[model samples]
Target: MPSLHEFATWEPLLRLLRTGNAGNLAVPGGHVAGQISHYGWSLPLQRRIPRPGQAAQVEDVQDEFDAVQRVQGALADIGADTISFTAEISPTGRSVLHLISPGPAVEPGIGGPHPGSLILVEDSVPEPWRRLPDPVPGAVPAPSVDLASLERTLRERVPGAVGATEAEIAATEARLGVALPDELKVLYRVTRARWEDWGEDHAVAERVFTAVGCELFPLDDLYIADASSRPCPWRFGAREAVVTPPDAAVQGLVGSPGWIAFGDNGGGDRIAVDLTPGPRGHTGQIIMLSHEDNIGAGLLADSLSQLVLEGRGPGRRGRHGDGPPAVARVNIRSLDSVRAAAHAGLEVLSLGVWEGAPFSLAPVTGLPRLRTLTAYPGTLADPMEIAELTVLEFLELGPEDWRVLVDAGAVPRGLSAAAIEVHGSRHPLQVVALANELLTLWDRPPITRTIVEGHLEPGV
Candidate 1:
């Protein structure tokens, strides 16, 4: 199975596979493109095709020491340039993380470095691919189509797709405060705010809607899928890689926006996407990003699967490999989308969103099959709607939103099987009430201190 980092790094390798060539190559992980990490190359300087179990060995100690020292110096010089690449045809990711030669390590023969021997250097803690740091203060936000423009296009262009009016968009933005990202803005303008809709040209409209194009390449067992139309082609660098069918078979495996689909390619490479929290079960599950649109539903799905895997109370965080379906955070905007995802064999969904956006409580009613629901700080209007889901086992409600749930008529009354955690919020009294209710209603209340601190507890 692939780790979160491996899954992302494989995009380049996967993109290479689309060319109909299956070969072994390493893709560095964590290092930015054009970054200078440890510098060294194959001695024979030839592309290697490692045979089954024929591990690439270190032939000379002096040459190896020289190479290792040089590589380390390069890393220190570049301030953390070691690269990690996922192999195009290897499943074990046996050597996914590697250091790229910053320059060249040429040690006069002690066994003039044999080919394929990796020289280790100072490995720096790689920073995550952070979204462009929140636009600098007073910076000009990228220009994008407004909600009105999107509404007009939808009304005048793709009349059949479901859409929100300009006023609705304003109301949502007003409720949230932060401006929508430019990528999202462009999508809304062209696709009427619906990310899933493939619009007029299944191919063309999808580009506008998804902000991703159809160019693909293969790397290891992963294929990097790119959206050509967008300015930032590297949607977080090689956005996604999969080993699924060509365009025709992709639809079958693409459950929603965040997840990608893949298929087996005979014997070239076996793919694995590991989102599981621990070491053992990690390889079997897929990793995903959460969204506010369907975050609630996504959470429910996650919690449901978690319950099945971990069981109640102390059993939730069990041993490494013996868990249920592995899940990650994701977003869900519409009930239809959530239902469709459910039908498509998606056992878990991850999401992050505001409280009052109708999602916090709506999933309880909208996504009947959801099991876990997680969220961040924000206000909420209603919470009573999801009071009766028996299957729900994990509820991660932020502190700010806890009070609304407590005040709502429904949440307290229908509480059952799951553990309800109130994250940081503004109201302590309310959190207490909610926690108290959980203790009273369920045999084992899932409330914890994190909830109180995130909301009521200060300096948290």
Candidate 2:
């Protein structure tokens, strides 16, 4: 099965899953496209193929990545109304908390699970990716936190970091008017006051004071607020406030009003807290800069405890992969496109909405890497030729389709997963019985998985 990162075609689908901001995302290709939201992914199975020049625009794309770029370009037309791309990326992202502020465009970070990753829809991007030169090998589970235990885990992982002392914490508290949050204070006491490290790309990579993002103050010299300090947040699709003519020595240019700038993710982004509470806001509220839109100093977590829990929560890390070549959904009006794809190294094909289409698989039987084939296979094609596919692993069709393939002794070997939708004239028992009869044809078991409609059945 493909991981969330692998399907470039499903990039928007993946993004919607990662960030629950609802929207429709898909390229013009029939390769992969879907409508998704907080609900679920509903694939746009069929796209009407434009004939000559009947209003539909034709786009030649390399793959899903190219498709996204092309589609974005198309949407970003000058004076384009209602059809504009959003530059707002959610800060509370999936695993990696990307701060999409209006400023410099941040490049996508590398490796597994870290902030600075966001959808290209927003304009504001934080600092570049950061990875320890040689990270200590271990993954900490963050289901719920054990403060002392996590502190010890961090120290053990990065033994070179200098741990903090009680006096150091007390001195810092004295310097800053407000006392540190109990959690923060305890965290500092247990772990290093701040740690510095190098990265493969960044020559002098360092956060405010913590490995998470920003450097702990005093660990790095505190600087007066200036152009070098404040980042210009991209306020596309939003009207986030800015700190024009910022305070000479302000912490965050547009963050909480009476907040202490504790750490930064080295991306000109800060993780701070508002010690002073107002009617609307409360003390100990962990406020951070918005990575998307013009929203500034939004409430990230209610407290430091929430921040810790989110950062280290179990199974919340980002998925990382080199990724395979993204495929596009092609309009299978006829077998011509299918033949072209197979000839051009099409490995997997899902011909949905095949009810009345002129579909046939006979032309592309000998392709080298054509493993998975999904289709209703009736409208204008015979299903028997599917047996010619020697490397079939996954299939989606109806019971009659399976019967045709089986009667002709054309069922592919080692079929692992299949969804055989049974409907129209066929009873559930009849379909189930047919499936069992087909099973008898196999030497052992033909396929590892099989499902009838939405339910599961053994040996499909």
The global C-alpha lDDT for each of the candidates, from Candidate 1 onward, is 0.30, 0.39
Of candidate 1, the 10-residue stretch with the lowest lDDT total is 451-460
lDDT string for model 1 (1-460, tens) is: 2222333323333332312222323232211111212454222122345679886555423443443354345346546534322122332322222212212211111111111111111121101111111111232221332445434543454455444456654554464343433333333333343334444345644433222121111111222111211112111111121112221111111122222212221232211122121222221222222221111011111221222223212211222222322233434442322223342222234344533343444433444445444444442344444464444434445443545554553443332222223442223234334444544443432222211000111111
| TM-score to native of every candidate shown | 0.22, 0.29
Q: Write the per-residue lDDT of candidate 2 for residues 383-423, one digit (tens) a residue.
A: 76677777655555666687776677776655533445543
lDDT comparing candidate 1 with the true structure = 0.30
Model number with the top lDDT: 2
lDDT of 1 at 440: 45
Backbone clash numbers for all candidates listed: 68, 36
Q: Give the distance in Å from residue 199's predicted Cα in candidate 2 to where it truly belongs.
A: 35
lDDT of 2: 0.39
Candidate 2 residue-wise lDDT at 225: 21
